[model samples]
Target: MKFGARNQITATVGTVKTGDVMSQIDLQVDHPHGMSSVMTTESLQELGIKPGDKVRVIVKAIHVLVAKE
Candidate 1:
């Protein structure tokens, strides 16, 4: 999941923020944007992620093309 950034950066997962129940979990990414976005609890859970660990981030842009639809 490594993306277009240095592989030496690291971050820690802090407290979980939930709003109005069933909300997306807010994960604290230490290094911020120049590398990757902080992942949410739900996102992490979906990807089987955990705290106190290093994870790779793969970034990509999705585009949709239309032809007189």
Candidate 2:
């Protein structure tokens, strides 16, 4: 799936932490920096994500629109 104009990186779902809330799904990705990522129910489903499932991780740089009020 093309998100805007940026490319998405293909990665595998290494680990997952499912919280008490059904909507809370924390995922640990096998990144070069040992970095992890956060994903929501909608996003997870969109990627067809599951434990041991493969998914694409898109990294985007965004500017802050507004300061914390």
Candidate 3:
């Protein structure tokens, strides 16, 4: 699928936790870090996401905030 988001990362499914209405998907990304996405259970089902599956993580945002101590 094509998306407008510029930040897309290829990752492998690590874990999937599905609730009654929502699901939390954890991706095992490249080296040292990973990401998580929360979506509706229906959406998750539509994507057919499962453990060990390869998927793209798309991130689109207008503003990103950074904090320094």
Q: Find the candidate with the highest TM-score and give its number.
A: 3
**Which stretches of candidate 3 lie above 4 Å from their native place?**
none
Backbone clash count for every predicted candidate, in the order shown? 0, 0, 0
Identify the runs in model 1 with alpha carbons over 4 angstroms from their true place.
Answer: 5-8, 20-41, 48-51, 56-69
Which digits, one per residue and each the tens of the lDDT, describe model 3 over residues 1-69? 798876788999999999899999999999798889999999999999999999888887554456899
Cα lDDT over the full model 1 = 0.45
Evaluate all candidate structures by whole-model CA lDDT and list the values in order. 0.45, 0.56, 0.90
Task: Tell me how far the alpha carbon of residue 55 in candidate 2 is from the true structure, in angstroms, after superposition.
Answer: 0.2
TM-score of 3: 0.85
Which residue pairs does candidate 1 place in steric collision?
none
Candidate 3: pairs in clash: none
The best-first sequence of candidates by lDDT reads 3, 2, 1
Instruction: Write one digit per residue (lDDT tens) for candidate 1, span 30-62.
Output: 546333244554665676554444544433333
Candidate 2 runs further than 4 Å off: 5-7, 22-31, 41-48, 63-69
